[model samples]
Target: KAAYNKYLSDKRAKSTRAYIISQGIDPKRIESAIGYGEERLLNGCDGSIKCTSAQHQLNRRSEFIIVDM
Candidate 1:
């Protein structure tokens, strides 16, 4: 989970920084964004836990926020 979170965080931060720069925001003026991954599961464990790990992982995701600089 930690590794996944780190990976997603890096991904989101890079993407956000690129977008901000592309929109004419100064690179140095912008701070980094953070990604929250898989921590907020929407579906409560419905029925059996027999679903494949890959299925559960599909729920795992990345989220991002822009730092106010």
Candidate 2:
């Protein structure tokens, strides 16, 4: 299960890269996509929720940022 989740997360990051590149963002100008994988919770919840599916979905979500190179 962990392996599969990581796989999907990686795929999502790659898609984001493709998107930025297609939008005329230089591939080299773009930074790498990072997937923290449920390590940081928005609500400070340690993922104690008995149901893991929803938590997994949330963890797979991506975050982006722009900064001076």
Off by over 4 Å in 1: 33-69
What is the per-residue lDDT of model 2 for residues 1-69, given as tens digits with 9 covering 90 to 100? 545655767788888889888999988787797554445556433446564666555655677777885
lDDT of each: 0.61, 0.67
- What is the RMSD of candidate 1? 5.6
Q: What is candidate 1's local distance difference test score? A: 0.61
lDDT of 1 by residue, 4-63 (tens): 766775687678778868999777775455555544554542224566676666555444
Top candidate when judged by lDDT against the true structure:
2
| Worst 10-residue lDDT window, candidate 1 | 38-47
- Minimum summed lDDT over a 10-residue window in model 2 is located at 38-47
| Residue 53 accuracy (lDDT) in model 1 | 70
Question: What's the C-alpha lDDT at position 59 in model 1?
Answer: 52
